[model samples]
Target: MKEELLFVRHLHVEFQHGGQKEEAVRDVSFDVGCGEIVGVVGESGSGKSTVMCAVLDVLPQDADVSYEQLWIRGGKSSAAMVFQDPSAYLNPTIKVGRQLIETILLHPEPVTEKATQQQKKNSRKRAWEHAEKLLEMTGIRNPEEIMKRYPFELSGGQQQRIVLAIALACRPSLLIADEPTTALDVTVQRQILDRLKRIAEETHTSVLLVSHDLGVVAALAKRILVMKDGEIIETGTAEEIFHEAKEQYTRELVEAARKHGSRSQDKRRISETILFQAEHLSFQYTKFHFLKKKSTEAVQDVSFFLRKGESYGLVGESGSGKTTLARMMTGIIEPSAGQILYLKERWKSLQKGRSKAQCQKIQMVFQNCAQALDPKRTIGEALTEPLEIRGGGMQDVWKTEAAETLFKVGLESEILEKYPGELSGGQRQRIGIARALMLKPELLVLDEPVSALDVTVQEQILQLLERLQREQELTYFFISHDLNVVRRICDRIGVLYNGRLVESGDAEQLYREPWHPYTKELMLSTLTADPKKMRRRRNVPELTSRGGTGSGEENGCPYADRCGYVMECCKKERPELYRFEDREVACFLYSEQHSGKRSKEYRMASQI
Candidate 1:
């Protein structure tokens, strides 16, 4: 039999809150073998993260924890944990390098017979070098430069890599990572998962990966443990857990993941009449300097249209101009070159047409509900602001409407009295969505609105959005990095690389047959729910090469550098948009093709 690295026998955790004893984690047991990857899958409040926290002895003082038997491979047990939110786990004020060094120094060891100053200097240098190496192992480019920066200086994906690096710095026998890649884009998530797999192989480290994303668990875990309301409901190998799930909750989760595979076929057809259009949209940010004035083009010549009551998806990696485009579309930022046409009326400019009524017409729901809602304001106040700004006739009417909207989003009316701090992350997000719905807008710009939510809550929110769209005829400009969520809700999909749209078609069509190399890469990087499928898909060739040499370009194919099917002409000139039946692909491969009988054949072959 293989040796086990860590063992948990009948662990139970409770908490005393407001004089009531609440069971947060029930009887749970699992084992992590040497060099094994164990996954704990659950939704919010399922106690997956709580169990890990209890094991690390980091639970709050008010909590009660007990276990029948907890043991480690070695007599001396040392463990490290990486949190879901990198920003919360890290000290925002400190530099990345300083925090890493401090964490490393926590494990006590006698210093060599040298001066105290020399030891301190050597420790810092050693910490820096170790941090650099770990970052490199995690596939981060320019590790030295990243080490010098603070948490806020890096993107969410970059910050996550830093957190993982810090956790691995201790070289603990057991590592606990809670939804480590939940915040990353698909491509970055794949790279991070690959790094974790490699680390487990090389260091023989035991990994306890906690996540609600089944795809992530399917890709990494050998043994699967399903938790619900703090109890371990099912435990088995990944294949058995996925294919032969016994518990109802486990089966529900498996079905949700499998459902995503079929959602591509259910995409709704887009209407011909464009409700919102952006023609040659270009935007730049001013770079203030004492010497020369310069501008960086955040979005360049981006054009797309949304039909009334349709959901249009915008997908790309972080810093790929996804959020910037959302801001431009919603009039949060004015474009320098293009015009936004709404209801067949062209706005002189976003800045010029900005008004309270216009703003009410296009509401936005941001990613972080905690930050988006005013900390001082109660939920009622937050939901009422829009109606107040619109100057409604009856206060009671507005209150009734707000209450109904809250109920529609799966929240109780009493929640309106509580402040944002009192609500959980999922509850706060629901409130945010409710606030947006209260405006009764024609369009809603949801920027990663459900990205921070758990899988179960995400399902509810998606259903709510779909319901509202059907009943109220609400149009959505959905921006997200999760391809699964986009596939579930979007009518049409647009692939953005850098600042340009390389592919546009029905969501089903694009997922079925992605012509753009960047789009194909994004799709390929997504982890599936089935372990067998995940392994099979990983072996499939990636669309691009190193440095992204063949991706299409601004003038030509932006994916030229990374594309596997790059041609000499692709390097010299950019490919124009080629119409192939109902889809449009920007690639040199179809340059010779015309929008006729041959195009239909190409579309059929591409399976779009």
Candidate 2:
């Protein structure tokens, strides 16, 4: 009974790579109704994104697209798109406010009467005001100040919000969001998701959400379209597609979502041997301006120890200093204060010929191994560089270690001759691991290692890492913003807030019964692939936290501004770690546990 916003039939697209023709999309047919949200989902290389790109006319010229029938009822100007990476799409040099208003000025609304220059000026001013409102609608706090900033000045969530504001500036009848909230943390993601839902409901706008994450797509879409190998596998309402898929591929995807989307409660073994320790580790970076100086304390007096052969997960929203802590632990950067002890010996720094064993005992894996590897170097050279730099008497050792590590990672021996670009993402990541194992490290610091990968690929990498740890007795310091991914691999976890360790405990206990108010918010923000759960999330109360979390202020409890149980003392002083039954929580409510009766209210609060 609703108007047809978009319709397509027999849509086909193909590309020629290395003289072999490849089909990206085949015989796809679907329609979007006014005020409806339609989701297209699949793993990488499934062509769901390609179909959306084709409609937007942003596909590369090398690809060919054709269809028997394709139409947008109100024409091209009535639609706008938000991309996965707003940094790539937005102009870095332009102020956000100017760009937001420019779109509205170019695509002005219908005017009934002729206007003079003065009237046009007034209209432009009013348009600027409307742009601010759009920013606020997208859940951006301090809209007026944000408008004056450039794209790079904003956080990932802020940039995405700005992009959404621009998309809605022209008042488009249709919105195309391609992985809009994929890289965001849980809090920011919930805000963006709720904003989009409200926009579609209040304005009667149509949405075509293209994503590989079924949970993200399910959070908004009513109807679902499954794509695989450039073909449509199934089409139905969310409930039907999730519960009763007709095709094997659709079932696999659904099953994968059910099994792999949210992390299961970990049941893994841990060692009692303390392999690494740091006491009161703190780090700071100073910035110099025009006759003025500014400093940011990236890490506070935070301390934690890793048991031998245990996976310790670090979870936090981005800019919460998780990566900074990882870097310090990896010895890539030294802590401005505190002592680092490995095997009961303190390591001052990784200087040449000083504590070589300590350096060898610690290794790190970066997020994007493909980017981390040099394109021109073969895998062999990369694997040997660590040993080669240490005065070169271990040539035979290097060769033997490279071969053994490659075998350990389940790669063929012949891959040593291939450049990093010649391998798949998984293979390249394996090589990164092999390189780290050149000296057979006892500890590995993995920083968002699988955050950018597909779900299947993520599972593969995690299993490989698990096998390696089990066989080699490795200790891991895993850092990521994804709580689910953390639960999938880590036995124990720590929650970081504004460079402070707010909570630490068993992964299952933390997710199920978080103590800190910030931890509660984080658990609530995690999205799962359950349609019913997502529907219920719509009724959940909005987080009380103010939007921007990019600021690095370290005066009090980093989460005081956002805590649901905030008090006057929360803003005045920082809380130290207090002992609980099986965990440590940094909160005043539990500070005096020596009497075995921490505040009763806090006991109730932790159950929340």
Candidate 3:
């Protein structure tokens, strides 16, 4: 039998809010065994994080927490935590190397005051060595260079790895990860999860993983705890929880995770006319330090077209320029090079300078609906503000239209009276959609619209978007890091890496057989709740991803360092988007210049 590392029983927590005591977590109980991983999963506000906080004694002073029995083998100090956002926890001013080394020196044991200078020096040296080793263990290469950079200098994946390294620095018996990959792209999320699994096996650390993503939980956890309304509804093995849950909530969660709406078999025919096009679009951000200017291309020469009533997905990881491309399409930011054609007409003006008619033709639903919708304004005002700005509509008419639009988005007319703060995440998202629809725009640029919502809520929003698209013949330029979500809604998908468009083709076909190395990695990185599929994936070898030292500076293929099929030519010259039947992939393996055995096999596969 496995040894139990941490145990809690009958845990209850409450906080004082608005003159009332609100129960955040109630009657929660669970245990983590040595070298075991346990997952707690539920929607937002279900108190998953609260239970972990209570265990760590990190709740606010106004809160009350208690348990019938609570114990860990090595006490709370022997535990370390990794949160969702690494940036929030890490110091911006300090180098990550120092931060990690500092954590190592402070934990387990600190140097005694009576120790000699040489002893202290030796201890510090050991800590630095351990820090680099931890960084390497988390899949970070060239740890010494990474140590010299601050948190802000690293990519999101790198930053998260640094945080994970810091947490492991103490050699803690227990590691609590709270929605650690919630904001990460699928590939990076896989890397982080892989690192966690490896560390747990190698160090015998117990992990308490908390997340709303059922797929993520299913991917890593041996045992799963289903939480809802501040209580654990069920506890079982991952296979049992995902496939044979007795609780309705657990079943519903599994169903939602599995149910990405398929493209309608009788989908309406998309118009042949191009609604928007970006020709060799490029954007550069110029930064100055000490009176010296340095320019970084956020987007490189790229081209893509969206047809009327079609959904085009731009898929990539964080910092892959998805948002930058979206901004260019929406006129939020003008491209530094190339032309934007809307309805075959050149669009040279920024959003502010665009005519009212142009504004009415394109609308955007921002990623953070909370920030997009003003806290001070009612939902009705938010919906009507666009019309008021565009003019030619009375206030009463605007309000009436707002109500109708709200109903279209599956929201009640009564929602208009509520403030953005009073509404839930799903409600805010619907409100954002309703506001975008007030203009009855021909195109909608959705930037990670459902990335932050629960899986169930994400399904609802995707369905709503599909319904709206079909009903209104609205064209969608959707951008996201989730390839699974994109496959569900997008007709055609483009894969981006380091500011370049590497592949573009039918969404289903791309998903079925991705030609680009990066695209294939993305598909493999996608975690699902299906037990059979996960078992097969577990047998696959870990592939190198496009993150880490020497990966960002490649002048040829951005993925050259990570590509399993990379040839010597890949490091010398960049490949353009070469045509292959109906698909286009930017890799030498599919190009005429390639003559190797692997290239021949890839070419034959492409034709098939």
Q: Estimate every model's Cα lDDT from 0 to 1.
A: 0.81, 0.82, 0.86
TM-score against native, each model? 0.90, 0.92, 0.94
Highest TM-score against the true fold, candidate: 3
Total clashing residue pairs per candidate?
22, 0, 0
lDDT of 1 at 50: 90
Residue 502's lDDT within candidate 2 is 87
Q: Kindly report which residue stretches of model 1 are placed more than 4 angstroms away from their true locations once superposed.
A: 75-77, 101-128, 264-271, 289-294, 348-350, 410-412, 422-427, 539-558, 569-574, 593-608
lDDT tens readout by residue for model 3, 1-608: 87899989999999999999999998988889988999999999999988888888888999999889998888888898999889999999999888998888888465457998888899989988888899999889789999999999888889989999999987889999999998788888887898888889998889999999987887789899999999999999999998889999899999888875344343766999999999999999999999999988989999999999999999998888999988887778888999989999988656447677887888999888999988999988889899988889689999899999998999889888889999999999999888999998999999999999999999899989988998999999999998878888899999999899999999988889888888888888888877566757852244355433234445668778777787777877788888766688888887665844454345445531
RMSD of each: 3.6, 3.1, 2.9
Q: Where does candidate 2 have its weakest 10-residue lDDT segment?
A: 543-552
User: Candidate 1 on 1-608: residue-level lDDT in tens?
Assistant: 97988888999999998999999988888888888999999887899989998888789999999999977766334678888889998898999888877777775245666659877878777777777888887667788787788899888778887888888877788989999998788887887887888888988888999999899999999999999889998999999999998898898888877665556343344466778888989888898788879987777788888898799999987777888888887777888898888887876535676767677778888999999999999898899888888785688887788899998888999998899999998889888888998877889999998887767677767877887777778889999988888988888888877677778899887888787877888888987899998887753232233222443443545567766776777776767766766677677666654323454344343522
**Candidate 2 lDDT by residue in tens digits, 1-608:** 87898988999999989988898999998889988999998887888789988777778988999999888877877889999999998899999999999988888888757798898999899998898899888877788999999999888989998999899986888899998988788878877887898988988889999887777877888999988888888999998888888888877777766665456443456778888998899999999989789988888888988998889999988877888887777677788898787777777765423366667889999888988999999898899888887555667777777888899988987998899988987788888888887877899999888777766667778888888887888889999888888888888899988778989998877877888888888877777777778888643345434332223344566667677676566676677897666698888766553225545565534633
